[model samples]
Target: MTREQFIKRIAPIAVQLRAEGSPIFPSVRIAQSILETGGTINPWNNLVGYKVGGGAITPYWQGKSVRKLTWEVYDGTRQDRVPADFRAYDSIEDGYRDQDLLFEKDRYRRVREAENPEEQADMLYMSGYATDPNYAVKLKMLMASYGLGRYDEEAVQLRKEWQERLQQLEQRKQALQARLQTLRQALAMTEIPEWAKEAVERAVQSRLIDTPLNGSYDFYRLLTILKRRGVI
Candidate 1:
């Protein structure tokens, strides 16, 4: 796929993940994805060349992996055609989530703690995330050329708005739940008033009401009046 298409597909998801508390910036994510995957999604959904390591399992990764020839640099020597087992995921989002989990490690703490995309990119290199000496430069170049940093701003605003919306919905939910609880308690009927006990019993026998005991005062009064009016 074209780079634009790749960005279009991945950027929104990366933005959402960032908004939802993934420490990785959208700019760094998109840049790394493009750099690693060449703007194309793999069938296994391993877009960032995340290799298998330490037998870690996340909700997003179920221990699936794929073998691929990868490049590596060591002590000023470059090595290519190195077959490696890269982690595979059920979906692109899953792949991103799994990669974000890797950033939780102590070794990658600096990468997560980086203040911005450029700093994060530099941290990724400094922390030995990639073997290439120019890994940070390449990432920064991609970010600059693609304007990926805009997503970070977008995510910040989106997260704020989402939190507000979530709070409103939560308040509404709590109100509804409390109302439901009150209604449930009301339905349980603590006592049937003496004035309406006979009417309530008759109504229950006639199958007009299921239980006569503990009917609310208003409910019992209504039933008695209705019975007197031959409406029950």
Candidate 2:
């Protein structure tokens, strides 16, 4: 299949990963696959930059390698190729599954705190996967360029819900704060002993207040009344 065809085929796999609660950044990984494999329909379906033979042999890519014009390694330079652990799969879903498994390994314990594709890719590096220094930067750039930052609608919706809840909490906190302030002012003015007028005055000036016991703003109005009378 063509590159676009491959992306279309694997997009649903990415979606499924999201549905299954896998926080892997599929978009970033997919972009890296594109860059590494040259496209989806290449001779070898090596998606995750896996060299051929699958071991610590030489960097010899027996299968198809992506065309790199400048470097011999990029241009099928199989001389220094090392045989690494390349998980073979029958389908794109299998490839994606391996990717998810790679992330789930104990080495990737930091995946949960990874907030972006770059961080996710970096974790992969930290876990001793790819040794490329620019792995995270390239993956991040590709994700941004292709708008692949949002791998699935489910993740996007989850983020949206969290943001909405945060907004609501902030609004409630503000409302509660205002109500508490009003209540504090009201309490300071209520049932003045006539001897504590100076104390009330000091309290009002200091603004060191607390929540109101009552739901009404009568306490604040009472304080205003006291102020007018010069009692506090």
Q: Could you say which candidate leads in lDDT?
A: 1
Which whole-number lDDT from 0 to 100 does residue 31 have in model 1? 96
Q: How many clashing pairs in candidate 1?
A: 3
Query: Candidate 1 regions off by >4 Å?
Result: 177-215, 223-232
Question: Candidates' lDDT values, in order?
Answer: 0.90, 0.59
lDDT of 1: 0.90
lDDT of 1 by residue, 132-227 (tens): 999999999999999998999999999999999999999999999999988877676686667887788779878998867766657888899988
Off by over 4 Å in 2: 42-45, 50-79, 154-232
lDDT of 1 at 145: 98
- In angstroms, the error of model 1 at 202 is 18
